[model samples]
Target chain A: MIVTVTPNAALDVTYTVDSLVPDAVHRARDVRRRAGGKGVNVARVLHALGADVRAVVTAGGATGAEFAADLGAAGLPADLVPIDGETRRTTTVLSAVDGSVTLLNEPGPELSAAEWALLAERVRRREPEVLVCSGSLPPGAPPDGYARLLAGRTSVLDTSGAALLPGLAGRPAVVKPNLEELREVTGLDDPIAAAAELRKAGAGAVVVSLGADGLLAVTAAGTWHATPSKVLTGNSTGAGDAVVAALALGLCRREPWPEILRRAVALSGAAVLGPLAGDVDLAHYHRELAAVRVRPEGES
Target chain B: MIVTVTPNAALDVTYTVDSLVPDAVHRARDVRRRAGGKGVNVARVLHALGADVRAVVTAGGATGAEFAADLGAAGLPADLVPIDGETRRTTTVLSAVDGSVTLLNEPGPELSAAEWALLAERVRRREPEVLVCSGSLPPGAPPDGYARLLAGRTSVLDTSGAALLPGLAGRPAVVKPNLEELREVTGLDDPIAAAAELRKAGAGAVVVSLGADGLLAVTAAGTWHATPSKVLTGNSTGAGDAVVAALALGLCRREPWPEILRRAVALSGAAVLGPLAGDVDLAHYHRELAAVRVRPEGES
Candidate 1:
């Protein structure tokens, strides 16, 4: 069973409008909510891929109920810790014409130490085969909470900044950082150099996603690069989560690292073809996987 | 005593964010909910102005509970009819810097005939001093339902479209339409011409709320133009509703037409400061009343 922990979970809402006019009244045509956090996103994707997963997070008030509804609707089993403050909500406004998305993010309710302890207890109760920690650390939480959550085992850590810095000390099985985050973490202009620096900072292996450009890796299997195959994009909301799921699967199944990168790229491409988040077609994934290019070091 | 009826009330939720992104994840920084609908706004403003006011509406489920809580918090009495469906929610997204608002309106649950019957029964029992009907006709309801709910010599009908057409035929004491809607109803671009046409159509009197411009009225006394002292602008979510509340109050007290529009403009100006619909500052309203200007015109 895969266990994903979202320390700062949110009820995500999306609004569809013709155009956003600042300081003007706009009538939104649509509103949608989903339980979100990096860990929750990873668990949902893995579950869609036929993996047994448990989504754990803390919540409160009506916003909390919304989070549960979102998870239940997505077919993910969830265990949530209750709190006094209402759970936070995230709003996204999508353009009705081209589907361009804008995001407004909230810092979220501050969690008490008791709540953190409660979440840790919930985690201990449901021992997951593979543990995934996602999103930022909520304020008041110790920086090393992610490392402690994994208990030094081979875990998949998908995060950046404060959590990423301290979380890297635990040396998770593999760390997945997007290209920008990799640069932010390592202060390097080059993606390859960033991945190497992150690996040096105690991340056992690093898979830095480069979006449309593809994937880069640095691990025991050696440095390698895989470019994504051409696939029509529909929505990219959960494609990154899909890549994380594919990478975790590859490590757990002990598949070859290069093949894992190939699969990750294909799965993400497949994800972009689906309408809503966490939706991917395995049929498309397999078809795209064969066309991926894996270039070894010094290939050029 | 002024009583306002909202057949389809809502828990208005406003989300404050930096920007909106579609299909992508965004977080909301602030969340606020209030009892909403045109009638509710009227009653809220009347209550703020020290008038004896009662708000009669239907509320249900958890959102309904929230609606009642907000009404209680605001120091207003709720003669709310309960329904099986939860009270509908209206979401508005506002940008903090720009003060721009976006509205996502939900067509509330269909009001069963039983619910409609219940609201009518409540009105009969109360027989308010000045009954004010506001807001759009919900689905599964006839526009003339407002006329069916209240029948008296002094009732005020402030509605549009179907509600306006049928309720006007019922010969309510007063009807308030903005200039644009007046054109749609009477096919007259001229205010005086439109007022005569509505009177011919059976309305006893008509008041045209011209927003920042001011109020135009054709009453039993004479034709009068009430112009506001200044445009103190901010958020104008419920300025019209505030004007309606003051109108109902004036008719109830039998205030001289001049004092009526003066107080109306003052109250309407105060409403411009509130973020939600129908909110007004009593102090602001009182301060501006002394400066309100009314000019009598040639009319019936």
Candidate 2:
């Protein structure tokens, strides 16, 4: 079973408006709420692909209750650690006229030392074949939170900034960071150089997601770049999580690095075709998988 | 004793950000939540002024619980009618850069016919000396909901559009509409003619709020206009609610038309000087009260 840990879970609220005019009042035409976070999205993708997965999340207050209810309604299994502070919410306003999206993210609640320990204990109790740690560390949480959780476990780490560097200490099997995150953490503009830096820092393998450009991986076996034949257009919100899900599955199956990279690229492209994050069109995935081209760094 | 009814109450949330840019992600610097609705604001203002006031509102779901907790924390008296639908939320975004404000309002939960009946029953049981109905009616609620509640009760009515015209059938002691609402409901640009139209429709008196210009009142005693001596520069969000609060108090105390109009204008100006709705700078209110000018309509 794969276990996903979300340190800062959120209740994602989406508001659809006719148009968004700055400094004006808008009446939302529709409102939707769901349980969302990096790890939650990753676990959701894995589950949707028929993988055995469980999510471990910290929750508190009313928003937390709603998040838990949504997760259950979605039939996703999770272990929830109770906290005193309320869980934060992320608001996305979609403008129907211009199709513009505006996001407002609330910095999640601070976790006390005791709360952090409780969360770690919960994840430890749910021993799994693979552990995936994703998302930002909440205020008051130790920066090395993922490092501590990844200790002695086969894990995939996905995060950015301060949380990103400390997590590398965990020596995760795979560390996935988008281009922006890669540059911010490594201070390198070149994706190849940034991935190399993370691998040297302690990552067993560093996977970099290049948005529509596809996935680049620096592994002990070799460096490889994978891309789809044609770019797919859709919402890219959960594309990275899809990549993470594919990588986790590949690790479990002990697939070769090239095969893993190809699957990751195909799955991510499929995710882009879906309206919401953590969802993918299976038909699109299969079609893209055949079109995905994976080659060693020097082969191109 | 005054009873204020909010058919569609909301949990008002304010997010302060460095700046508001369209279609961009924002991390809120600060967040604030409060129980709010027009009637709730009126009740809060009256309570702050040491008046005997109670608010009647419908609430449900997690947001409702928070709203109730806020009201309790404020030490305000209230009657909460439970419903199956969740209370709505209104989000206000404040940009620190240019001090611009953006508002997003969620349509409140739809109340069932039974729920509306229950709300009316609760208000009837209270038998308030002055009944104050404010804000929009929720979906599934009668457009003439205020009319039914105002029947045979000394009251002040404040609403717009369909809700406004039907409410006049109840013959509320006073009907207050701002310039925009007067035009929208009566289809006349002239406030005097529009106010007259409403009075003819069964309203005992029509009081029109003219923003910085103060208030215009047409009553059986006489036609009068009241204005604050000078414009107070500040947030005007709750100024109308302040006017309603003063009107309720004036009715309870049996103040004359001109005296009531003077107090309404002064309180509204003071509310503008405060940061939030339902709050007035007491010092400013006192100072403005003395400077408020009230004169018969025909007099210069």
Candidate 3:
């Protein structure tokens, strides 16, 4: 089964408020709770795409129970490793009037050495077809700890920070970062130049996601750039996760570069229009995929 | 003893983030959990004011446990009536960058008939000198619910909506509402006119809080207005509760009308700068109270 690992996951809560005022009382109009984290986000999108995937995550306390309850409510495949402190609760406040979103993320419960070891052992036991480690490292976790688990697997590293740099030391199937993150990672502003730097720096392949513009991929075969059919406007909360989800599925199916890039762009575009983060409009995504265009980086 | 009846108390969780981007992930710099609800706030603030107060409220499940835990951590007196569903949690996302606050309020767990009876019985048994029924009315509770229980005692009503209307109909010793809420209750924009309407409508006495402008009290003796020595700039999350807290304490001591109003305004002004809603800066409040001035409404 397709597997995803989220070292730290959370109970995601979204609130709708009439207005937000500084240090004042506000009456919330509505609220929705779900399970969230980068890797968990990727797995959710994959599940939405009708892909059978197993999610491996760490949680603790009543908040962990909240995560499990939310995941169970969604019918997602979960292999949650219980720990000590309560799992964190991440809040998203959606101001519908102005379409402004505020995120209040809790640093998830800290993981002990024993819990981390148990997680790694659990991953070792499940020979997942494709292992995607996405998002930030939780507190108490070593930066490259996620990458070390990719030793015998075809892992996709899609996180930023000291973690991403160290993870790149061990070449993974692909590492997807946006233009800004690419600039931060390789100190190159131009997409082509940045992709080149990543390839040279040891990444097996580099897929640089450019919001609104689309995605660019560089590999041994060559380079390709793909753009969505239309610039759809909506929340872009989980667009990157959608791209990662499609990229992993495409890798598993051995889809050609052009098809993979086109599909990923459409999926991300659909995700931008979804109300929930990491959720894509399947019909719209499928319809838009056929219209996505991929041009060979217009170079040799 | 000061008795606070929080029929609809809550567990307040505050998450502070750098910026709030709706439906996106945010990293909270601080997370503070505390016991909340109007009555609970009154209990806490009153306790801080040297009044021995017992928080008599209902609770259930983990949410209730956490609510009780917060009270325990603060070293406040409490008598939590156990029930079925988990207590509700009120989440506030405070943006660290701008200090903007957003609230996500949950409809608290429904209390069974047995639970309601138990609460009423508890109030009947204690009969503290001054009783405060503040905040929202819990679900499954009738509108006149609290008023019926605190029947003969000198009760102060600090609430709005159906609960406030019914409590007023029962002739509570004192009722306090901000100018706007007083308007909502009396359908008049004028504070004095609104307070007069309430006094005529079965309310024993009416205290209409006008922020910055000050506090106006209408009683059998006469109507008087008390203004703080200085208007300080700060949040007013629990300013009204602080007023009620000061009132509860002053009334228990049988302080004169304008003196009660003076003390209430000073405490409320100090509360504007306090961390927790309804909390007052003890030193500031005391110092400011000494200089608080009360003016006759007209030949009082």
Candidate 4:
């Protein structure tokens, strides 16, 4: 089974409004809520692909109870490690007037050292074939928390900021960072150079996401570029998680780099067309999978 | 114990942010949450004053569970009636830069006829010294829901719109409406004239809140006006609820018209000095109570 870990989980709530007037009251036309965190999203995508997946999350307080209840109601498998701090909620206000999204993310609850230790123990017991660690670390969690969780397993890491900086030292099988994250990590505007820097820093493979342009994959097998035949646009909130899910599944099946890149690009494209993160339109995914082009960097 | 009923209860969440920019991400520095509604706020204020008080509220789903937990944590007494729909949440975004509060209130969950009957039964069992039915009615609940609950139990009605219009016909011992609500109910811009119209509509007494101007009481005993010594400026979100609480207590003690207006004005003003709704600065309340001035309209 593919195992994913989310250190800072959230209940993501989306409210659709006719218009958003600053400093004025807004009555939402529609409201939707889901269990959210990068790793949780990744696991959700993998599960939707008919893969065996389990998610490990830290939960506490009333919000935590609600988060767990939401996951249970969705029939998602999770291993919850109790903590003392209450989980946070992230609210996204979608203004239909101009198609703008306003995000309000709470700083997640802080974790005690003992709580981190418990989380580490829980991950160890899972015995995952392809382990994936994603999302931001809770306050007070060590910057290298993901690195320690790696422990030389066949793992993928998808995070940014201090966690990503220190985690690069403990090389995972694959590292995925979007364009902005790459700039933050390497202080370079060039994506290729930043990917190379990450590769040199012990990452076995480096995959850099370039938003609408698609993704670049650099590995010992050789560098590859993959893109969908047509651009699909909706809410691209969880497109990156779709890519990570694809990569983890590919690792579990021991797929070739070219095939993996093609699937990742197609799935990520399909995710954008879907309503929420971690969900892909099966029809669009199949169509895009056939049209996705992946080849050596020099060929394209 | 004084009892309060809230047909539409809410989980009130406050987020303190550096500044609010429309359609942009806001990272909150601090967050606070509590149980809230007009009647809930009244009960909270009365409870804080060491008075025997119990709040009866409609609750459902995870958010409802959290609302009850918050009340329990605060050591407030409550009787929660179950419903099928989830309770709503009201968010207040406080911008530190300009001290502005942006309110976002969700239309509360709809109540089935059975749920409303169950709530009414729960309130009846409480057998309170003085009953208070406050706030807006949920969708699907009858506009005269508070009128039906009153049942001539020496109750006070604090609501607006259609709910207030029919509720006044129940002949509540007191009907507390702010200046705006009085105008909306009677279609009269004059506060005194609007209050007089309400009194003529079977209401025993009419109290109109005038915000910074103070409060006006139109009762069978005599017309009176009460004003605080100075205007306390801060968050006035719960000032009116405090006035309702004071009125309920005064009705229970059978206080005279002038003393009741004086205490209600002071307590309402003191509520503005507190950081949150349902809380008043005790020192401010005492000082303002002593300095409060009350006089007959024509005798002055």
Candidate 5:
């Protein structure tokens, strides 16, 4: 079973209005809420694909309760670690007219050292065949929190900045970073050199997401570039998580490296076609898979 | 004891940000929450003034649970009626640099027919000396809901539009309508004639609130105008609720028309000086009371 840990899980709320007028009163036409975080999105997508998945999350206070309740209502399994601090809520205002989305993200509640230890222990006990540690570290947590979770597991790490540096040393099976994140961590303008440098730091493989340009997969076996036939334009919030889910599934099923990259690219494209985070149409995923083009680049 | 009925209660959330740019991402510096609605605010202010008060509110689902928990945390007494619909949450984004507050209000949940009767039954059981029915009606509720609640009681009705028209026929002890609401309901530009017309429709008295200019109280006994020495402004969201609270107290105390108007005007100004809804500084109230000006505006 796939197990994911979202230490900074959130209750994501989206308010859809006719149009958003700044510095004025806005009455929302529709409001949608979901249990969210990077790892949570991965688990949700995996579950949508009919895979057995469990999400280990830290939740507290009223917002935390709402998050847990939302997960239950959606039929997503979660092992929640109760804390004293209230969980944060991320709000997105979507304009129904033009489809412009504005986000308001709150800094997550700080976790006590003891609470961090408790969360680490819970993730370890889950015994994931393919573990996914995702999202930023909450305040008061050490940067190595995700690194510790990746210790004796074949994990996919999706995080950036302070959290990514220490986590790279733990040798995760895959590290997914966007173009900007790759530049920030390695301080290198060249994407190929940055991925190679990240691999040298002990990441098993590096998947560099290039947005509309597709993905660059660097592994010890070989390097390959994969791209969809055409760009799909829509909400891109959960595209990375969908990619991670495909990679984890391929790793668990012992699929070929080239096939894994193809599936990941297809799933990422399919996720973009959907509206909400973690929402992907399986039919769209299969259709995109046939149109994906994968070519092996020169050996690393 | 003053009893307030907030048919549409809310979980009020405030986010303080450095600056809000239009259609761009904002990272909030602080977040605050409370249980709120017109009647709830009136009850809170009355409680802060050491008046015996009880608030009857409708709450449901996860948001409702949080609203009730917040009320309990604040030590505010409330009688909550459980319903199937989830209570709404109102968000206010306050700019730390300029003190600009942008409000986003959700249309409240639709109530079942049985839930409406339950709420009416609960309010009647409270045996309030001065019943206060305030705020908008939830979806699926009859416009005459407040009129039914004001039956066989000396009540202060504070609402607008369709709800206010039906409630005015119930002969509430006092009906408070701001300038805009008066114009919308009566379609009269003249405040004096509009207020007089409201009285003729079976209202015991009429209190016309002219924001910044102050209040005009017209009763069968006499007519009086009351105004604070200066227009104190910070957050004016709860100023009307404060006026309703003072009016309820005065009715219970059997105060004269001029005295009641004077206290209402002072409390309204003091509420504006405070930062949040229902959070009037008693010291500010006392100071404003001394400077309040009241004059007989010729008998009606």
Candidate 6:
């Protein structure tokens, strides 16, 4: 089983409004709330694809209860570590008029040293074949939070900034960072250079998600660039999580690097077609998979 | 004892940001949540002033639990009727850059017929000396929800549209509507004419809140206009609720019409000086009370 760890889980709320106007009052036409976080989304995608996956998350207060309930209702396997601080929420306001989206993210609750240890212990107890660590660390958490969970185990690390560099110490099997995150960490605009920097730092393989441009992979086997034939238009919030899910699945199944890259690109494109993050159209995924093109980095 | 009824209660959330720009993502600098509804505000004000007040509100799901916890923390006396539908939340985004405020209100959950009856039964069991009905009725709720609660009891009614006109049939001791609501319900531009129309519709007295201009009251005692001597600037979201609170207090104390009008205007102004609804600066209230001006309508 693949175990996904979400250090900072959130209750994602979506408010649909007629139009979004700054400095004005709006009455939401509809409100939808669900469990969300990078690792949670990754696990959701894996579960939807009928993969063996379990999510480990930190939960607290009323919002946490709601998040846990939603996860249970979705029939996603999860282990929740209780904490004192209330869980945070990420609100998305979708404007019906122009289909524009505005996001307001609350910095999640600070985890005490004891709380962090508890969460780490929970993940360790699971003893899964593959461990996927995703999302931001709450305030006061050790920067090497994901690295602490690695313990020389096979892992996929997806995070940014301070948390990103420290996790390299554990030498995760795959490190996935979006293009912007790669530039921020490596101070390199070129995807090839940035991916190389992460691989050198300790990553067995580095995958740089390039949004609609697709995925660029730098692995021990070889460097390859994968792209979907058609650009899909929809919410791109969970596209990266989908890519991480695909990569984890590929690693678990021992797929070749080229095949893994192709699946990652196809899954990422399909995620964009979903209205919310961590969701994808199965039919779209299959169609895109056949059309995905994977070639060596130097190829035209 | 004054019993304040909030048919549609909310978890009011405020998010403070550096600036508010449409179609852009924001990371909230601060977040504050509290129990809210027009009646809840009125009850809070009364409790703060050391008056005997109990808030009757409908609550359900996770949001309701949070709301109830907030009320308990605030030490406000309340009766929460349990329901299956989750409580709604009203989010206010405050921009630190320009002090511009934006509001997003979720339409609260619809009440089942059984739930509505239970709520009414709970209120009737309290046998309050003075009943105060405030805020909008939830979807599927009876239009005359406030009227049904009035069983020849001394009451103060503050609502709009269909709810406003129907409550008058129960002959509430006072009906308070802001200028905009007055026009919508009575279709009259002149506050004096509209106030009179409401009295004719069976309201014992009609008080029309005119924002910075203060209040216009038409009663069996006399016609009067009251205004604060000087304008106070702050958030005006809960100013009307403050006016209703003062009116309920005055009625409970058997105060004269002129004295009550003066207090209402002063309280309303004081509420504006507060950062949040149901909050008042005691110093500001005392100062404004002494400076409030009240006169017969003809003199004005």
**Each candidate's fnat:** 0.61, 0.82, 0.67, 0.71, 0.70, 0.85
Model 5 CAPRI quality: acceptable
lDDT of candidate 6 over A86-194, digit per residue (tens): 9999888888888777888898899999999998888889898899999888997998888889857889999988899999988999999988889999999988888
Model 4 lDDT per residue over B108-176, tens place: 889999999999898889888899999889999987787888867898999888798788777899999
lDDT of 1 by residue, B56-108 (tens): 98898777888988988888876989888777777677666656655666567
- Candidate 5 colliding pairs: none
DockQ metric, candidate 2 = 0.70
RMSD, model 2, all Cα superposed? 3.5
- DockQ of candidate 6 relative to the true structure: 0.66
Docking class of 2: medium
What is the per-residue lDDT of model 3 for residues B1-300, given as tens digits with 9 covering 90 to 100?
988998778888777677665445567777878888878888888888778889898888877888888889889988888879778778766665765555667767778889999988777677789889988877898778866865777879898867777787667789998877898877888777888888887778898888888888988888898888888765466788989988888889998898898889988988878866757788888799888889888654
> Candidate 4: interface RMSD in Å?
1.6
* Of 3 and 6, the candidate ranking higher by TM-score: 3
TM-score of chain A of each: 0.93, 0.95, 0.94, 0.96, 0.95, 0.96
The true-versus-predicted C-alpha distance at residue B82 of model 3, in Å, is 2.4
B182: Cα error in model 6, Å: 4.4
lDDT of 2 by residue, A1-300 (tens): 899999899998888899888777788989988998888989988988899999999899999999999999999989998889999988888787876668888888999999999999988888878999998899989989999999888899998888989998899999999888899988999988889999999999999988778888999999998988888765566789999999898888889999888889988988878666678888888888888999898787
N/CA/C clash count, model 4: 0
Instruction: Assess candidate 6 and give its lDDT.
Output: 0.89
lDDT of 2 by residue, B109-139 (tens): 9999999999998898888999999988898
lDDT of each: 0.79, 0.89, 0.81, 0.86, 0.87, 0.89
Candidate 5, residues A1-300, lDDT tens digits: the string is: 889999989988888887776556677888888888888989988999888899999999878988999899989988998989998888878777876667777889999999999988887787889899998899989888888888878989999988998998778999999999999999999888999999999899999999887889999888889888898876677889999999889888888888998899999988887777888878889988888888887532
Q: What is the lDDT of candidate 3?
A: 0.81
Q: Write the per-residue lDDT of candidate 5 for residues B238-279, one digit (tens) a residue.
A: 889999999999999999888888889889988877778888
The TM-score obtained for chain B by all candidates, in the order given, is: 0.91, 0.95, 0.92, 0.96, 0.95, 0.96
In candidate 1, which residue ranges exceed 4 Å CA deviation? Answer: A14-37, A69-75, A104-107, A136-140, A160-162, A174-197, A205-233, A281-287, A291-300, B19-26, B150-153, B156-167, B170-211, B215-227, B275-278, B296-300
Taking the tens digit of each residue's C-alpha lDDT, what string does model 3 give over A188-297? 77888887777776678899998888998998888898988788876677789899998889888888888888989999998888887867888899899899989888
Cα error of candidate 4 at position A59, Å:
3.7
Q: Stretches of candidate 2 above 4 Å error?
A: A186-196, A204-236, A256-262, A269-275, A291-300, B178-236, B254-262, B269-276, B291-300
